[model samples]
Each structure stands twice: as structure tokens, then as C-alpha cells.
Target: MAAPITAALLIIGDEILSGRTKDKNIGYIAEYLTGVGIDLCEVRIVPDVEDEIVAALNSLRQRYTYLFTTGGIGPTHDDITADAVARAFGVGIDHDPRAVAMLRERYQPHELNEARLRMARIPDGADLIENPISKAPGFKIGNVFVMAGVPAIMQSMLDTIAPTLQTGARMLAETIEAEGLAEGNYAAGLADIASAHPGVSIGSYPSFSTSGFRNQIVVRGRDPVAVARAVAAVQDLLHRLKSDGVPH
Candidate 1:
């Protein structure tokens, strides 16, 4: 079987760290990558600082099959992602005719000021990723994809780039709920089951609501048969605990 395709996310902007603007892209991107058979292994949120962005980009792009960045590509002064990306790749960056053409569709000659023209600057040898919603285009250089900060525009860019990415075997998951059960009671047994099934990943999540406490065990694996075996093991463990009159 081919190795699992993996990716990382780099979220850029001061507003996200300051909590001035809540981030709505990470979860969406995670789910989207999962559906297309790409595992999102890591995520990092960095400020608008060029060095920070460059460092994170260099690390993630080399560590994974793809590195997706969101935010910091805008008309404002703080949007330095393009420059950082260029520096990270040791490439020259300038106003690209293709990007400028795309922007021209939305902005007239008089409207395209210096600040607004900042959107047209792209790294050397990078391919443009179309933005259907806004005329401004995103660029992909090597394994890194630089997208807009706005949720809508980022999502649109993802759709445009999805077809170009190579995918791996899709991960399968099974969820078993342990009603009125506490995680501590089943923690040891879950660990044992996980050790037995090296191919599967098992996680236990606990939640408390006004009604009471509830626990859920999720098993994920690329092999459906292995996932099923892990699920059965978990269920059997739960049954044995219940038979022992263990308080949930």
C-alpha cells in the first residue's frame, strides 16, 4: 500500500492570536483534508512577523506532503505572507502578470493603487490558484499553498487546489458511546486494546452536560477490518466492566 498522504496547516495573522478575530478555518480544513484521504497531522498559528512565518513555512512544508497556509495575504501593510513565502523558498517575488490580470477583472486601473497591487505579488515559479469569489489569486510554490485569510476565499481556494493533490487510502472510523460511563474506569482496558491493534488509533473523549457525564470511544484506521476488530475489542471490554458492576 502507498504511504498515507500527510499535510500541515499554518494559520497566519495577529488577529487570530489576539482573539480579535475568531478562527473558523482550521476545523473546516481538517475535515476537508480527511475526506480527500489526506491526513492533517499538525497546525501552527503564527503572527504577521515575516521571520516567524518563514520559519514555520520552512518546517511544515518539508515535514509533510503539503503545507496549507491561511491569512496574511491581503491589501493591508500587515499582509506579509507572500514575502515570507518567497524568502522561505529563496526565490524572487514580484508582481505577476497573471495575478494582476485576475485582479484587473475586479478593480479598474484607477482603483488598483499600490496597496491594492500588493495582492498581485507572487513568488517566482509559483502557479496561481484561482479564486472564484474574489478576483485576487493565491499561489502554490513547491509543496506550500498560500491562501487568503478570509474563510470564504480560503475555502474557495481549497476547492480549486483539491483536484491537483495526490490522495491516499481513506481513513475509516467507528464511534462507540459508553453511556453513563467515566473515562477513568475504561482507560486501562482501552490502552490494552490500542496496544493490541497497532494499525488502529483509539481515543476516548469525555463530556459533561446538565444531564450527566458521557464518554465516547472513537477508532480510526485505514483498514476497515482492523477498525472493526478494535471496535469489537472496545465493546467487549465495556461489557466486562459492566458485568463487574463497575460504576459508570
Candidate 2:
């Protein structure tokens, strides 16, 4: 049987929930997963606590085809992702020699301290995910991929892993910008269009101009043919609006 292409994100940290940091990874991950045809079912944010991490790990990993965890893997006092994964999986976490060796090669003798190598710990039988920006590698335990929290590093890691992921057809998006129209005026028509095309995601974004509000109706779907047809219909609807030609 083919492995299912469903995924979930476990964002771990106290900083995120406490509002010390705004979680940027969730949005990026959602977009990335959508692009790769993996349906992102859920997003959970847990504190740096071990028990909390363990619970989230167990729940998400078991439920989703692929579980991606962010944060709590740094070389700091708070980093608890490795230990949590071990507990969740009913296994032991050990400092892998390969990870240690990589760290040794990257850092100067004095720089590679014991605390810095805290990232070397990995669950038994897990594979390491490549980290180009920083030598501290992320690892995969079964279907769970542990990645960095930082946007740049996370993006790089995602790029490396994305090619190996199974993705369906790319989603097609059609956007037509209308010069002058209030969102309220088009909301009903957009709702009708949205209902007509169940598979398509239609949106109306309104922007203000010198004249008045301008609405851009965007329609998107996985099927290109359906999107194109919907887009033409939207254009035809817009043409009938019969706007007053105000001199610029």
C-alpha cells in the first residue's frame, strides 16, 4: 500500500505561546505542505516541558502520516525534543558518533563544548536530516521529521526533504484585479461562485483607491481546467458590473 501523504506540525516552545515570539513556521509549513500535496491536518504548540512534548509527539506522530517538529532541539538548557521523542517512542536517546564527528569538524576544539553537542543526541534507528546552515543536524524518527525553529534553517531543511516527499498535482490559482468595487458588493456573488465550484477556494481582497475600494477576486483549485473555467466566469461577471468611468 502507498504511504499516505498527510502531515501535522508540532511547534514546541514556551516563547511562542507566551507571545514572546510570533510563530512564522506554521504559515510557511502550511504553504509548503499545500504545495507538496500533503494535507496539513493540525498544528499544536507545546511548551518546553518534557511531558508536554512527549504527549504531543505521540499523538501527532501516530495520527499523521508524517509529523514535523520544530524547536526544542537547540544547544541550550531548554532544548528537550530528543528526550521527549525517546520517551514518546518508548526508546532511549543516545549521542550519535556521526553527529558528534560532524560537530567536531565544524567547530574549533574549544568551541565544541559538551553543551554544544547536546544536539548530537538522537533516538535509536533514526536518520539524520542535513543541516547546511548549522552543523547540528535534525533527525527523523520513523515518520517524524525534527527540524530547526529558525525560518532560514527550517526552510533549507524543508528544501532538502521536499524532493523526497510525494506530492500530487500542483494547485492552480487565477487572480483578476478589479479597479473599483466594495467587498460587500461582490461578497454574495463570490459566495455563489464558491458554492458552484466546491473544489475551488475563492477569495475577495478589497483595496482602497482614489475613487473607492477595489476588489480582487482570486479563485484557486487543484484542477487547472476547473480553475480556468471559474476564472473566465468571474471575468464575465466583472464585465457586467458596468462601472462609472470617472476621469483620473
Candidate 3:
């Protein structure tokens, strides 16, 4: 099998860090990447500081197959992600004619002030990611994709770049509802099954409601046969425990 495609997300903005703006992009991006068979390995939220953004950008870009950054590529003084990305990659940054043209479609010549033109500044040699909503393009330099902070625009940008990304083997999963079974009753058995199936991952999720505890065991793996084997073992263990009249 080919090596797994991995990615990391760097969320940049003081508003996110300060709780001024709640984040909705992380979960969306995670699910989207998962569907495309790219594992999102890590996520980091950093302030608007250029140095901090540069450090995180350099670190994550080197560590993962791809690094996606959202927030800080806007029209304000605090929007410094482009500059930091250029700095991290040791490249020059300036207003790209393509980006400026895209922005001009939404903003009139007179309305294209310095603040708004800030959105046109892109890293050298980077490909522009079209923004269908606002027309202020995102950019891809090296393995890093710099996107907008706004959730809607960020999602659109992700959609635009989806076709270009590399994907690995799709992860398969099976869920066994252990409704009347408590996790403590099956932890050891689950561990044994997990050890038996080294290629698969087994996890138990328990939720509490007024009635009692509801447990769900999830088996996941890149190999479908491995996942199925693990799921069967977990089901057998749960069935045996229930037959023995183990209490929830």
C-alpha cells in the first residue's frame, strides 16, 4: 500500500484564540479531508503575529504532506498570513495581477483601496485559488494552502482545491451498538481484539443520558477485511458478555 497522505491545519487569528469568533472550519475541513482519504494529523490555532504564523507554517508544512491555513488572509492590517507564508518559504510577495483582476470583478476601480488591495498580495510563484463568493483568491505555495478566515469562503476555497489534492486508501469503519453493555465489562476483551487485529483501530464511545449509559464500539482500518474481523470479534465479546447476564 502507498504511504498515507497526511495533512495539518493551522488556524490563524486572534478572534479565534480570544473566543470572539467561534471556529466552524476545523470540523468541516476534517470531515472533508477524511472523505478524500487524507488524514488530518494535527490542528493548531495561532495568533495574528507574523513570527508565530511563520513558525507554525514552517513547522507544520515540513511535518505533513500538506498544511492548510485559514484566517489572516484578509484586507485588514491584522491579515498578514500571505506575508508570513512568503517569509516562511523564502520567497517574495506582491500584488498578483490575477488576484487583482479577480478582486476587481467585485470591487470597482475606485473601491479598490489599499486595504482591499491587500487581498491581492500573493506569494511569488503560487497558484491562485478562485473564490466564487467574494473573488478575493486564496493561494497555494509549496505544500501550504492559505485560505480565508470566513467559514463560507474557506469552504468554497477547499472545494476549489479538492480536485488537486492527493488521496490515500479510504478508511473503512464499522459500528457495533453495545446498548446494554458497559465499557468496563468489555474493555479487556476489546483490548484483546485490538491486539489481535494490529492493523485495525478499536474505540469505545459512551454517552450518558437519564436512562443510563449507552456504549458504541467503533472499529476502523484502511483494510476492509481487518476492520470486519475486528468488528466480528467485538460483537462476539459483547454477545458473550450479554449472554452471561453481565449488567450494564
Best by TM-score: 1
- Per-residue accuracy of model 3 over 73-170 as CA lDDT, tens digit each: 88999999999999999999999999999999999899999999999999999999999999999999899999998999999999999999999998
Clashes per candidate, residues 3 or more apart or on different chains: 1, 0, 0
Ranking by lDDT: 1, 3, 2
lDDT per residue (tens digit) for residues 164-210 in model 1: 99999998989999875689899999999999999999999888889
lDDT (CA) for every model shown? 0.94, 0.84, 0.94
Across 1-248, the per-residue lDDT of candidate 2 in tens digits comes to 23437889999999999999988899999999987788788999999999999888988888988999999888999999988998888888889988888788789989988898898998888888888888888988888999989988899989988887776666667789865555665567778878888878888887777967667888877778788878877776666664544222
Runs in model 2 lying further than 4 Å from the true structure? 1-4, 207-214, 243-248
Q: What is the lDDT of residue 238 in candidate 2?
A: 65
Candidates ranked, most accurate by TM-score first: 1, 3, 2
How displaced is residue 32 in candidate 1, in Å?
0.4
* Ten contiguous residues minimizing lDDT sum, candidate 2: 239-248
Better of 1 and 3 by TM-score: 1
Better of 1 and 2 by TM-score: 1
Q: What TM value does model 1 have?
A: 0.98
Compute each candidate's TM-score over C-alphas: 0.98, 0.85, 0.97
Q: Look at candidate 3 and tell me the lDDT of residue 234.
A: 89
